[model samples]
Target chain A: MNAITIEGIEKSYGKTVQALKGITLNIPQGEFFGLLGPNGAGKTTLISAIVGLVKPNAGEIRVMGCDIRKNPTEAKKYIGLSPQDININNYMPIGKIMEFQGGFYGVSVKESRRRAEELLKYFKLWDKRKAGRYQLSGGMQRRLMIARALMGKPKILILDEPTAGIDVELRHELWTFLKQLKEKGITILLTTHYIEEAERLCEKIGIIHQGKIIACESPLKLIEQHRLHEKAERSGAFQFVRSGSLEEVFVALTGRPIEEASKKSGEEKWEALPASLL
Target chain B: MGSTTRLAALVQMEFFRFWRLLRQTIVPPVLNTLLFILIFGFSLGSRIKEIHGFPFIVYIIPGLTAMGVMNNAFSNTSTSLHMAKFDRSLDNLLAAPLKPFEMVLALVTGGIARGLLIAILTLAVALPLLKQPLFSFWLTLYFVVMQSVFFGCWGIIGALRAKTWDNLATTQTFVITPLAYLAGVFYSVTILPPPWREISLFNPLFYMVDGTRYGVLGVHDAPLWISAGMITGLAILLFAVCVWLFQIGYKMVR
Candidate 1:
């Protein structure tokens, strides 16, 4: 069964700003899927739509073969989300937050407690388990959010920029933990600004820009395809030249210069990877 | 089976969330009501004498109790929603297998629980200071529960409309505060002239306070059934609106 399937999904904020535009993709069960895009490429919008947070103007989404619109509760049972903003209540203990999240997913108190203990330790937050949200550093809080998401034992996990503000060491540690989760056959869908992360972790990547999918392929295959096309265009004259990096390929496909794409905005842009790539 | 179980789970989570923030969730309102009783019930009761054939302190207790229930109910849902919005924790909930009705029920019930707890706590603290038992125990309990549910729905309405912390503050200041004070917490409607008394009848909160006071003191400015019917009708109306908002994924989840 497909873990997630999107068909002609469309969303617009207010009347003018089209956040998502007729996006369609299918994620196989247990696949590590990466939604890659520059800022304002509608990555979060697509993720939010699939998670049922934002209503789509048109189209359908199916999770584990259950239509999200018609069977939202059933679809949601299999999904867990760790949003981009790590905003938990600072007044509450970390353990309590975890318990609350677990309960929301129908976990019994005893089960929630056990899961919290295990996840807190796995995330290296056991020592700070009793601390209020304010006591943890930024990275620790992000980790705690991830742990909270995992508390329900969801079959599908969506992480939106999980390592955005974390340090290098912690980022590496999180990636390792994520890999372990993937190995257990949990279907993971992640949106990240870090190209290297998508390169390393994603088995299949979909580069989105301006609410459209520009490319959907294995990372290595995408890079190899672009290399072959470039070589063919040059007619063997520049065969000795080093192949272009993913960053270069991304820019070439999307048409937004890398420098301009990296600039921060109030809302992260995830527009279709420039139409040029397709 | 799916809906009921998920609803129950959401309610359980809601309570857990409130328990975690007990200091903010449960404490302040009880303390505030206690102080109101001490200052108004004791200090002012000395001067005001009796307002409705009962000591001033006893007369105001039911109103104050209703106020406490309303305030807690409002704060509980409003703050929870705001925090969810700010921390993005709501997204996790939105992604879950729960329906919008389930979420609304969880939040509204959680608010009611806190409201009930604060009402009980305040009553417990006020008991020692009372000159006598204020009203029939069963009627008082009914009014308190109804008032809590009513205002809890109001809180969800406010939270759904609020986009920022300041917006919530504005709701409390402009909406809840006016409703509480104007609901006749301090004085009887019999003392008011014709036009104002008629206007007071329009304020739904007044019925909540009056019905609750009638329940407690057995003396009421409005007929008991009238007040009860009004409150019940208003609660149903507000609940419908809240449920609709939840179904559409209105401001709360989006």
Candidate 2:
């Protein structure tokens, strides 16, 4: 059985922006999946649609066999989403934040606190439990979000640019944490700009361009097939000379230069989708 | 893990949030009520000894208490929701397994809690200081809770619709403040001549104030049944509106 099944999902903002255009995809249970795309390419939109955050104009999404539209509560129980910016309730103490997240997922206080203790210590955030949001650094904040997401003990964990603003050391630390989650039989869906990170962590990668999935395959398979070779200036515009790295495969496929994302791009695009437009 | 427990957990977070900012949330309003008791109730009371045969100082306590309840309830939900929308944190709540009605109820419940707390604290201080007692405890509780529910739901509507800070403030400034003030907070509506008195009747806050005064002072200008009906109907109507708005995702999602 698949961990997630998305069937012909479409989303439009107001009348002009059609964020997702009939996206259909699936991730098998326990698979480590990576979703990659350029700015405005609809990666976040697709992820949001899967998690039941953004309602699609037309489609069906089933999470662990529960239909997101018809059985949202049951579906949501199976998934824990670490959005690009979940925006921690900055005022609450860190410990309370985790418990509150668990409560939302119907985890009892005792159970939530137990899980909170384990995850916080595992994430190296235990000592900071009583700390305010401002006390944590960017990397610690990102880790807190991931730790909070795990409070539900979800079967499928979805991370949107989880390692966005962290330093190389912290990014590696988060990668280790995520790898641990994957080890525990959790189906992982990650979206990130670091092609190398996806290459190292994902079993399968899906590249979305202009609201459509352009490529979906194993990282090695995608790289071996594309086999970035030097091309002329007009290899149909935006396409660059072949480079061996998966980043080159991404640039080659999307026809856009490497975007200054991770730290900025994903969040900027999210903000750009003005509330007034809805 | 039950639905009710889940709802309480969510509502408890709001209380925690308020406590974290206690100086800003609790102290200011309670002090504002005390100041009004000193400035408007007593200082002004000396100049004008009575209104409707009650001491001017005592006559204004219920209105001030109602004002505190209404404003706190409105601000709690409005500011919280607006900040969530602004920071894009609303996605977390939307993604939670809780139903739309549960989410709405939790937020409204937080509003009610804050409203009632302020009402109780304000009354405790003022009633004892002035040697006043509740003419009817249940009626006072009824009127206070109803007003909180109405404004709390309105707060959600305002936060969802507003795109900017100024946009959120527009309604509070232009609509709620004016209506609250003119709705007989400072004086009896029945004392007004002709159409002015009739105009005051249209404001919902008038019913809240008049009803509260009747409960506190055993005097009211409007019929109790009509006031009761209007407050209950408006509160229920707004509660339904908030629930529908949450389910639809309204301006929170595209």
Model 1 misplacement above 4 A:
A232-245, A256-260, A264-278, B1-28, B38-49, B128-131
lDDT tens digits, residue span B122-156, model 2: 99998775576799999999999998999899999
Residue B158 local lDDT, model 2: 88
Q: Judging by lDDT against the true structure, name the best candidate.
A: 2
TM-score of chain B of each: 0.93, 0.96
| lDDT tens digits, residue span A138-245, model 1 | 889899889988987989999999998899999998899899999999999999878889989999989887789988999888887677556454433233333565
Error of 2 at A137 (Å): 1.2
Candidate 2 structure quality by residue, lDDT tens digits, A1-278: 99999999999998988899888899999999998876667888988888777889999999999998888888998888888875787677889889888898888888889999999998899999999888999888889989988888899999999988888998888888788889999999998767788989999998887788888999888877767343433354335434655766676676555464332557876787897588
In Å, candidate 2's interface RMSD is 1.5
Clashing pairs in 2: none
What does each candidate score in C-alpha RMSD? 4.7, 3.7
TM-score of chain A of each: 0.89, 0.88
* For candidate 1, the TM-score of chain A alone relative to the native chain A: 0.89
Candidate 2 C-alpha error for residue B247, in Å: 0.5
DockQ scores of the candidates:
0.54, 0.56
